[model samples]
Target chain A: MTSLVIAGKTFHSRLFLGTGKFSSNQLMQQAIETSGTEMVTVAMKRVDLHTPEDNMLEYINKETIQLLPNTSGARNAREAVFAAQMMQEIFETNWLKLEIHPDPRYLLPDPVETLKATEELVKLGFVVLPYISADPVLCKLLEEVGAATVMPLGAPIGSNKGLRTKDLLEIIIEQSNIPVVVDAGIGAPSHAAEAMEIGADAVLINTAIAVAGDPNVMAQAFKMAVESGRMAYEAQLATPHREADASSPLTAFLD
Target chain B: MNLKLEILNHNNMNIIINNNSREVAEGCTLERLIDEIGYKEFKFAVAVNNQVVKKTAWDETILYDGDKVIVIKAVSGG
Candidate 1:
């Protein structure tokens, strides 16, 4: 399987993990280790920079995992920008997961705000990875404005719906100049595998692993699934067929 | 009468705004008002409070009375 590279960092594992809703930090760390992820998404609000006993950072630090700060609560470009700046100061990195969903119900991204933020964040020297709809045009616009990556949701965040935007995702994969990391609503290892097979640079999972009966085991399962799918992709599976056909009699004239 | 005159002066500016209730004076530049609101620390885009104001232009543009001022933040993901 090909290594996923973003900003010169090579990641052998395409299964990126999220640090949220896990039963405990220990389990979260174990799951991350099992998943073999080098990068993990951590919500900006969850990080306690002042707390000496910050629990989450403890496990995360040992693994040497790169922390990707997310703007989960921000409602518009203004709030998002503020959160991003604060996160950068706290985390000491410009890498950000730009999210701008205003509505509390569906958590759908506001495209207008996302586009606006991308333009500004790029100027502010951020490696902006925006969470947006599966709109191909928006992706292109983000790229045009110098976003580092475009994270398109397969379904609503935490929905576990798994690749609802498969068709559009295919188009995005085909056309995108930047890496397409499929984030949100991935239900199972199979879903991660499917995304890998479709040429996603990476896949981020949180609720699926966190909510599993045994998160560590599930994390291992995801690890294997990601590898298996990536291997299959590299091997290039044969074209699918409908049914086995008997000797063709339609071309009997030529025979 | 002065408030009405200030409102009329603000209404004459070419900038677009999203929130008209801010009651900003006629000749106040966006930078001055943004500082006044103490929102400089918050990451945001100003639309004169409708049309998006580029960061570079924040200092140059002026706000008027009844102008809609839209302050937008970045948000996404459920």
Candidate 2:
């Protein structure tokens, strides 16, 4: 499969897994290995940082997975900016996943705040990847503001709803100059495959693998599915037909 | 009361806080201050002096004079 490159780093695997809600760190590690993911996401919080011996960090570092620190807790542009700066200092990397949501219940990304954060982050010498809704207009706005990638959610985060916004995602894929990574709410391996088949550069999954009975096996499944989907996409799928055509040709007058 | 306010005014780090300023003593742990502020309803993480402080270590961690404390929400997206 063709490698996926983002912000000067080439990723062999297009499936990016999230490190959260796993039964154990061992399971999480197994899942990461199984998925063959080159990049994994981790949230930045004061509590996790305080415990310098956090097993999550240790596990991820041992595996040599590239860490993508997310501003998951920031409510507004100012807070997100602050968190981004702190994360840069802590992680020693300019890469960040800018997530700004004012509402806590649904966890939908605030478009205005997200756009604002992306602009500021890009100016601050960070490789900004803003998480947003599947709004094509918002995606264009983010791209114009210098975002390295636009991570639009497929469904509500952790809901495992598969490509509910497929139409909008298609628009994003067609319009985007930068990479379009389908970020949240992807449940199964098939969902990852579908996203790739539709030309999504990458997909980030969390709950499905973390909560699975056999996370390692599931991770491996996802790995294969993503690769297969990417290969299919690169191969160029046949145009789909809406209705069956007559085998012998219904309009035979000309013939 | 007047002398304490005067001393606070002279301090460079001291800023006028409207809510529960009296509850802040000269030296109190972050845990104690958070409890006093009644912010337990919200899921928050604390950073003291530019360093992250875990919930487990909040009680043992003491707050000194002129320290900057930032309390942020835990799950803030959407």
Candidate 3:
């Protein structure tokens, strides 16, 4: 029911989808539509640049979906900055997902480069949503640098590990001045629910839904889970106590 | 006779776009190159010599012989 307002734009869905790993572009479209996500991430690469046919954008319903281009292949600040500028120039959206991972194996975010790029991108008048490790201090620094939101990973990208960095993510979510979007390592709808229960403004998922037996059905499931989790959080579920007491009371004093 | 000879003498510049060698009209601008490549409806970015050539500069930016141009598309990624 509640909308997520990020960078002055309101999103009706708290579940943001990543457009990758689908069997086909058509399938990806079906999943995206079923998920009801307003924002989706796209990656830029040299191979796709030369081939005009089979372009991914053709499948995305741009009228309904807002494209969030990511700096996925960039390994440092300079490369990420270049990718961001290129993405804005081409995609016609200033919203950028700044991801700089020098490591090819785990695809972890480089905190130093992310900080450097965020500061630079903010100064360039771009709405920056940076993906980083679930480091609370980094989240604060990114906020100070004027990032639109902080997207911290629950685990390594595409690992399907499901919230391996739960403690760090909770700290970030608790202290973040900007929206904390839980991104990466979410294997199932339950993982999304867990992230939402902890007060994440949004959860970004890709590999989990894309690789499911039925991606469209899985998308719907995640959407429902995210909505239910957000609703539960808003309702203020009662906290559990360390010890249980009898409803009638264990004993009466000096009766 | 002179017009036919001039037309036949004209040379197209050879350049590498996204690692594919192609020939374009002499003194072609990056804007013209994009138009020639039939990417009018698609969203893409251009880089020459590993340096990004901004969209604002496309019209005035001339492509030189043997320049390495990279055209990239924003596809699905996580």
Candidate 4:
């Protein structure tokens, strides 16, 4: 029942999937259907003239799923803005996943470029969801610049390390007023559950599912994990303690 | 033969599309070019020299010799 609302649009599923890394488009489609994700991220690329590919858009049902186009290969703000414009025209949606990673080595987002692009894209009427490092101040700045959501990395993109920035992400989640989607480096279903339990608005996952031994089953696992984590969060987990605590009292009569 | 070749050259111009050189009829509209390049069946957005061209304007926009045309479509990514 806890739906995620961004830019006045309601998303029933908090598990956002990335449409990448599948061996085939059919597998990707199956994974999406199995995961029950309402929001998915896509990237834009120049069409190959020699070998035009089957349009992947046909597989995605627009009525059921929301397309979130990303500026993944943009190395700077200018490129990101240009890609946003192109994406707006191609996808016919203003929902953008703004990522400006200049370095190919780590693929760490350039925070300065991300902040700059977010401000510009927001002004252009695009709902910007910026992928940034787990810097709480940067998250605040992005929020101030009218970003719809802040997607702080749990680890480097495609690393599968699982919440390496937990402490920083916790601070970001605690301080942020807008939705905080933990993106990247979430390798397992448990990681997704952990993220939700920590009160993340949502989690974006791709590599973990696409490369799994069985993507369909893995997708189902993630779906259940996200729901379970969200339910646990809603139920309010009990406080943890280092010392032993008795569940039952010792009665003098028994002694 | 020489006269025919001259006429053909005058009516056509070479343009760069997605980094490949191609011969399109002179003053060809972007819409026509898209059809010629087999992109009409696909969903895409186009830009000429880094400026995005709206779908509505594709019919009116013309391409010249050596002009760079970039057509982008949605691909899978995270």
Candidate 3: where is the Cα deviation over 4 Å?
A: A47-52, A245-255, B1-10, B54-57
- Candidate 1 per-residue lDDT, tens place, B1-78, comes to 999988686555443333234555558888876676553334444565335576678799876655666554321112
Model 3 root-mean-square deviation: 3.4
Report the first chain's TM-score for all candidates: 0.90, 0.92, 0.94, 0.98
After superposition, candidate 1 runs with Cα above 4 Å error = A46-54, A245-255, B1-78
Candidate order by decreasing DockQ:
4, 3, 2, 1
Predicted complex 1: DockQ = 0.03
Clash pairs (backbone) in predicted model 3: none
Candidate that would win on TM-score: 4
What is the TM-score of candidate 1? 0.71
Off by over 4 Å in 2: A48-53, A245-255, B1-66, B70-78
Model 1, A49-155: lDDT tens per residue?
Answer: 12323335557663467778888888999888877776664455788889899998889999999999989999999889899999999999999999888899988
lDDT of 4: 0.93
TM values, all candidates: 0.71, 0.76, 0.90, 0.97
Of 2 and 3, the candidate ranking higher by lDDT: 3
Candidate 3 lDDT by residue in tens digits, A1-255: 688999888999999999999989999999999999999998887744444567788888888888899998899999989888888867888999999999999999999999999999999988999999999999999999999999999999999989889999889988987899999999989999999998999999999999999999999999999999899888877788899866686676878
Q: Which predicted model would earn the best lDDT? A: 4
Q: Best to worst by lDDT, what's the order?
A: 4, 3, 2, 1
